[model samples]
Target: MLRMEILKLIRNNVVALIIAYILAMSIGINILSFGFDELAWVERWLPILTIFYVVILIDLLFWMAAMQISEDMETNMIQVMRTSRNVIQYFFSKHVLLLLFILVAAFLGIIPMADQFGFVLNFLYVTLVFSVVMIASGVLLAMIVKKQSVVMLAGSVVTGFIFAVMVRLVFPLWNISPIPFNPFEAFIKAYYYLYLPVEPPNQSYVALTLIAVLFYIISLYVFKKLTFDRGFRL
Candidate 1:
């Protein structure tokens, strides 16, 4: 199942899009980063890199997740395969695929910034947890939504809300010591302490890590219950 999925990924435009996404982000963001005065001197580039552009990646990831499952549901492939194989394992293969995709994409995406910051393990750690949350969120959205287009839209909306909340964009005046469960927002601290000698409190990491686990459990439960009959669409 996993091998077949890998073949599908390689044969499709998803791989190309990931490369494009990373390249566009790396170059376009450098231009955008300069619009703000003293972006590097003030250490503000990381936040802009993370919050400003991540929605595009989120949309791509959600679309990938939805396309993987929704296309199967839209056709008879899943139905035909269910007779011989565990369909749940088939879906799980997609989950693993998305995990690997994000890790690689994120690791490569950091290359431009790595010249100054070098490679930071915490960046990968934050990305690892973020990918887990994103995969789980994408899977859960796939389970609930039956159409590729519809699921993509809905997943973006759901993830956008979560992203807003996590970074305190929803309530800047909340005056909270620690923010809500968020992974993408950790991009700054993940590098600062290691590269710039600026120590981080790490309060957000602890909180976001907890939610990442909870989201995974919930996604697996819903994914296990996923069924074609339950999402029958003409």
Candidate 2:
């Protein structure tokens, strides 16, 4: 049943899914080239990770959710499901599918640059946690905003704010310690700042993973409580 539901979503959103991959990869490559050259060796990793998460992963997932799920709502399919089957399964199934899609897409973007950055496993772990958080945020927004345009707008704003906090505020402050910054150190810092990915020592990776998990639980609870009406309803 879960596989069938996932296949249905992929079939329905094939076009948007293709576009999302193209846009994410293009942006990832371009940023990798331009951003790395500008920063000193010491400073490049955080900036790259921040751009990958904030600009690409977070932004794309939100847009993908709005483009895909919002269409079903507009056509009243979601409303019909409320009366017939398990709404919780439907909601969670979509989230799982989206999370899976993001994990694959992130691999495609990060694998090529693995050698230049570091080990594939480290990059994969960071990308996976970052993707999970973005998916959780997008799913949570989708539950509330039924209209396509509104969902798109609200998701963008919400993601933008989260990025602002993570990259602009939390990370910079966390990285200011006089201690030398290395990739390993950066990873540890990120773990400590887990709420923001811009911090070093990848402590932020831990933060992102924990945050995504919490948001997923809250989103599941909210989805279970939502009563979808039989007719076209928001």
Candidate 3:
């Protein structure tokens, strides 16, 4: 079933789309930063990378979740699949596929800057954690809405609102010197600290991990509710 799901993603051109988007963005960012001092370029582009990573990557997850869920519901395949397999395991397989997509995308996106930035593991770690949260959220949204168009619309609005709130309000309020409170702000600070000599506090890592876990737990609850209570209704 997992193999079938992966093959379906490829057949639908979803894999190609994700690869193309990540490569395009990475190439574009690399080209744009070409004449600048290497360190300066990384410094300037880090925020852009963060923004792009958050918005586009999350949007891709939303698109995939909506499409996959809608197709299953429309074709009534989910019902059939659930009868034969553990529904939770089936849902988790979707997550596994999404995580694979994220890993490929992140590698493509980060490779261009690796030589210049010296391969920041923190960037990859944070992105993977963020991807988990986003993937779970996307699946939850798809399960609740059960309509591709509505899922896309609502996902965009919700992500946009999150970006706005984090950048404009949350980050500013919590991005204190030496001890940042918000995970997004910590991400930014951690990125800078990678290049600069300053060491990021351990609390940032702990906090982000905890938040991701919380989001994953909530998403699972929503998934269970949809599977059992709602019967995965469309």
Candidate 4:
């Protein structure tokens, strides 16, 4: 079942385009920064990863989660699929496919920085947590709001924009603690700040990951209860 889900993503034209874009950006980012003698080797990758996760993958994963499930519901394919597999199995297979995409794009973007074990480890941790959090966020939202996939895709882009603003423009400028809203910030901050020589900012992110897990649990329940019934009503 998981294999089938993965193959579906692999064949998706958008997914192919995205992977090609990742490859282009991976090389392009380096090319654009070609002559920076002052730039540290490790410093170069952060931007690539930043653009990949912050600008692209977050919304992509979210939209995929929502759209794929929404399509399944709309066509009553989900009902058919559910006959052989429980709701949990169905949703998770889709979720894991997107998660795998995230890891692929992330590793591709950060390949140059691979020698730095510390940075690589932190980035992978954040990337995994981030994939789940963003997918859950979209799936959770989609389960409640019935709409076309295009509508949801647009919403995901807007969300990615807002998240970028919050993490890049707003959060960094302020010194205020975002205890209640830390997960959003921590997803970027956890690894972005790891290269700093100070005490690791690992604590908040660990807590944030737990919160993300909670969000995912809620998303699963919502998928089962909300989406599972919609096919019959249709």
Off by over 4 Å in 3: 13-16, 32-43, 50-55, 78-84, 112-119, 165-203, 228-230
Q: Is candidate 2 or candidate 3 better by lDDT?
A: 3
Q: Pick the candidate with the highest lDDT.
A: 4
Q: What TM-score does each of the candidates earn?
A: 0.67, 0.60, 0.73, 0.77
lDDT (0-100) at residue 131 of candidate 4?
76
Model 4 steric clash pairs: none
Which portions of model 4 miss their true places by more than 4 Å? Answer: 30-55, 76-79, 82-84, 153-183, 197-203, 229-234
lDDT of each: 0.61, 0.54, 0.63, 0.65
Off by over 4 Å in 2: 1-50, 53-55, 76-84, 113-118, 162-207, 228-234
Give the per-residue lDDT of model 1 (tens digit) for 135-226.
67677677677686687468666566545544554245876454455445554344334444455456566776787888887776666555
Full ranking by TM-score: 4, 3, 1, 2
| Ten-residue region with minimum lDDT total, candidate 3 | 176-185
Q: Model 1 reaches what TM-score against the true structure? A: 0.67
Report the candidate with higher TM-score, 3 versus 4: 4
Comparing 2 with 4 on lDDT, the higher-scoring candidate is 4
Tell me the alpha-carbon RMSD of every candidate.
5.3, 7.3, 4.8, 3.9
